[model samples]
Target chain A: MLSSSKVKLIQSLNKKKYRQKYNLFVVEGIKNIKEFVFSNFLISNIYTTEPIPFMQEHQYQIISHEELKKISFLKTPHNALALVELPDTLPYSIQGIQIALDSIQDPGNLGTIIRLADWYGIEQIFCSETSVDVYNPKVVQATMGSLARVQVNYTDLKKLLTTSPIPVCTTDMDGENIYTSCLPQEAFLVMGNEGNGISEDIKSISNLKLTIPRFGKKQKTESLNVAISTGIILSEFFSQKEKI
Target chain B: MLSSSKVKLIQSLNKKKYRQKYNLFVVEGIKNIKEFVFSNFLISNIYTTEPIPFMQEHQYQIISHEELKKISFLKTPHNALALVELPDTLPYSIQGIQIALDSIQDPGNLGTIIRLADWYGIEQIFCSETSVDVYNPKVVQATMGSLARVQVNYTDLKKLLTTSPIPVCTTDMDGENIYTSCLPQEAFLVMGNEGNGISEDIKSISNLKLTIPRFGKKQKTESLNVAISTGIILSEFFSQKEKI
Candidate 1:
């Protein structure tokens, strides 16, 4: 059984302000809750339809389907939902290849990129202030347990790029072809907003402007989606590894 | 001003059952509305805050901001929202290089692929029946007006690949390295589901299995996002054209 106050607390997490005050975010669905149970994150609360062994480390409540449904954002409630404590603010660490986002607002894109970063073993991900809330439940779901492994921090993209010791590279249509561009092994790769591309301020800070050259045709497309572009660019880095 | 009945009608469009039964789908934003206006699609109704001269040829209705707000599904109501008559069911005439998706449920992926197809001039996209509804407002929004150019259809992916006249190639980790593989000028490239990759049932029909060779350390990423893989594979086709 969920207390009225507890239900209100869970609902309040949907807002950024509440999330800030509590330093907690909700992770919905069976797949996501299970992943969080094993990760290092502090499980503040667990609402489950059935017993889950991983939650043995943390206190949990066996809630009925109706009670679980009350707290679920999903129209069809999954078997479980969890409220996880956010990790400590990570310091800006520029080591190997890092991915940066400039005002990417979609939760799915942010989450998928986090997963991609985890997959490629990227050093870190830097997000501009306007990027989607990384702790958004949808993004956490999309990350597929990757949120535990990758370090994503929100920062001032333009300021960071200017002071960063490493070269900052960004993809642009008019830029040199990425296929032939001599990219450094350790660099900061910046992706821009879905509609606006990279901000003008950050664009000026980039050391190199590269492009994933499209095929010869009448391209009605104005630009590639930033996330998709990131994938291709990251693959280029990964493909090089396959050769050796 | 939106009448009570009209407001209710517009809100109903958010559901797939309504869209399918009425053979109508919503297209919002000034840019998208303008694009679809020029296309062959018939505009049934239009509600806008700003004036649209192109819409003179089609049947339209001017509504106040409050009325537009009542009907709009977007988080921030756009300048305009339109209801367009769904295009006539297009028969698949697979001729040149075509793209097929197996169980791709993300609207953004579907939209990005649609836009990419439009850029490369690949006219048709074949999706599994289980894929997200193409007319989902999110899908339409993500396409960025590419819906005007690309024709998308849902069908049995496995059956189509088996009988497709052109070669069917799907991306896989164990498959041949795509960078050096001899790719055909015209073939059907099948992309798999988001998490599961390609389904085995469809794999049975894959004639030429190709892989986008990963670079970096082998243990880094488990696999690439299907949409990112789509961009890379499509870029290669275009890359050859650039050489020409």
Candidate 2:
């Protein structure tokens, strides 16, 4: 049984402003909710059609399916939805191979990149202020529990690139081929917007520029998708590091 | 300038059943339409809100913005939309490094893979019968003009695998590390469904099983997105091929 006020609070998290105001975001589906239960993220509320273990009686609301639907954003609502408290935006302590985003607007792209970063053992991601909000519900759902593992910091990407102590690399059409280049073990890798490559301000300060060579015969493709490029580059970087 | 009958015909192309019945598909956006105009695809009718050069007056209908919105599937309609004649499905011919998809259900994934095939110079893609139709409007939109270059064929993927004349490679969790493997230049790379990867029948016939190494500590991530894995594996294959 869900109270009207509780339902309204869950629904409100869909908007960026509300999420910021409350410092809360929604994570849906049983699998995602289960992953969150074991992670370090603090769970404020759990609403489900069925009782789930590890959820205290007061913390969880065993609501009817209709009530669950009222709060779910999915077309077909998953069995459970959880409200998770957003972690504080801690200062980035750059370690190895940190990712910098230059105004990536798509929630799905940002989410997938975070998951990729988690897979490659990257600890931190620095997003330009214009990038999609990390707490967006769609992004949270897309991350598939990776949001708990990776730390994201929203900041001025241009300034970070200029002040970076290590080598900074960004992709370009005429840049050195990534396949042949010797990428550093520790560096800042910048990926850009879907429509535009890296911003001019950040691109100008980068110490290295790289390109993923096009193998197609006609080679008519404008460029690889930003997220796909990141995967390939990261794979190549680790493959090289492992070889040495 | 579009008649009621013509508008109805254009709008009907959105549905797969209707598209098959009429042998036509919708291609939106000025860049996409221009690519089709230059490619082998025959444009049956083009409806635009503004006059477009290089289009014969009789072949194009100058319609109001409201009329375009009525027929367009996109939330924000582009300047023009074109009805393209579906080319006949030609029999598959063996080629260098083909991609086979088994039950790939997402339109965006199918489309992105097609574009990725175009980028890596893979000329042909074979799809399981249950895979999403390549002509889906969402797919055509996501391809971003690469659909014009890559040839996609829907066929019995199992039969193709059994009869494959070259090495067949598929990704699995416990397979050999892709970095150290000697990937053949001519092969069929099979990527599986988003949730349930490579069907059992297809897996049995594969000659090579490769895995993309996960570098994350604890490695809680189950797997990379299918399309991202495709990019990584394809990059590795071509890079090795180029090395020799």
Candidate 3:
């Protein structure tokens, strides 16, 4: 049975504060819920309109479609919504081309970046405290199922860069061309905010600065989207790895 | 002054049929409007709350914030909005790397692709007739101002591929690794729909197939987002050109 208090609690999970307070995050859709079910994450509750074959062993409540609509963050509600316990943050020992996001405001951008990072075999991502919450529902939906595989850590970006053992690289306009540059295998590739690029302080501390050269004639395109830039840069880094 | 008739006309533009009937589309934000004003596109009217120094010679009307909210499509409306006449489609002579979008349904994906195309110096994009309208307000807003520089045309996808003189490359799972493949300087890189990917009919006619290899250990990520895939592939294609 769908209760008013349950619906209110589910709706409150949309905000970071509420999600943190409950120590749980919402994952919608049967496919996404299945991912969390199989991952290291723990599922607290599952609400669905129909019986899920894969989730038969888990405790779940069958609710009407109308009830699903009340708690769904999407414009079109998926068949299922699962409240999963937030996984405890594990200490990250970076061993590869880790991504560092500085003040990434858009949830969609952060989500897409995570999905791409998974495709490129990137295991970890470090985000500035100012970046959008990884548990944001819009972000969770956009990541598809990749979020379950990738590890995202939130920390102080400046301190992380300064204390790093390997080289720290930042994407810059006047930096060495990425196509010809000798990219390090082990490094922190820091991506900046959507509007401002990288912060001046972060840029000053970075050991290497690389750029994706533009081929457009008019030179009018202001910049590439942060997520798109991440994908392109990562593709290049991995492609170079294959050559060696 | 904002009239009821003007408000109705602007709101009607949100629909594809209405936009085609009027042969006009909406461009919001002072920066975006400026791009169209300087481009070959004709500006029908401009509505703003503040004086636009660049648009002083152009016909414009000052409207209050409440009135602007009624005419604007954005949740948070920018200072200016302009109606631009849709440019007549130009005959595209396949020259460099042209993009063919097969049944692309998402406006944001199309918009981001268009923006990236502009940055990569891809002058023309051909879309399947079933694809989402390029003039969609959501698409226009997402493109930033790249819509002014990049030309998007809609036509029969299968027919275009069959008639094309150069190689028609399609991104597929079983195709050649894009990192190692010999990419052509002049070819049509066809990106598929958001969900189903390139239609069967369109895929059958393609001369070549390309795939972005996944590095993730789990291989659980079903597929990269179509837009992100496009960016990665395009980056590789362009990077290869610099090597030659």
Return the top candidate by TM-score: 3
TM-score of each: 0.84, 0.96, 0.98
Candidate 2 lDDT over residue span B174-199, tens digit each: 89888887788888999999999999
By summed lDDT, which 10 consecutive residues of candidate 2 chain A come out lowest? A216-225
| Predicted structure with the largest DockQ when compared to the true one | 3
Q: Global lDDT of each model?
A: 0.79, 0.87, 0.91
Candidates 2 and 3: which is better by lDDT?
A: 3
lDDT of 1 by residue, B10-33 (tens): 788888898988888999998888
Q: What's the CA error at residue A20 for candidate 1, in Å?
A: 3.9
Rank by DockQ (best first): 3, 2, 1
Expressed as tens digits, the lDDT of each residue in A66-145 for candidate 2 is 99899998888999898999887776677678899999998889999999999998877999999999888889887887
Q: Which stretches of candidate 2 lie over 4 Å from their true place?
A: A54-58
Q: Which residue pairs show collisions in model 3?
A: none
Candidate 1, residues A56-152, lDDT tens digits: the string is 7347778999898888877787888888998897666686778889999988788878877876677469999998888877787777677876768
Each model's RMSD to truth, in Å? 3.7, 1.6, 1.1
Ranking by TM-score: 3, 2, 1
Residues B107-199, candidate 3: write the lDDT tens digits. 999999999999898888999999999999999988989999999989998988899988999988999998888889878999999889999
lDDT by residue (tens digit), candidate 3, A1-244 = 7789989988999999999999989999999888888889998999999999985645899999999999999999999999999999887786788899999999999999999989988888999999999999999998997899899999999999999988999999999888888789888899999998889889999998999898889877869999999999999988888777
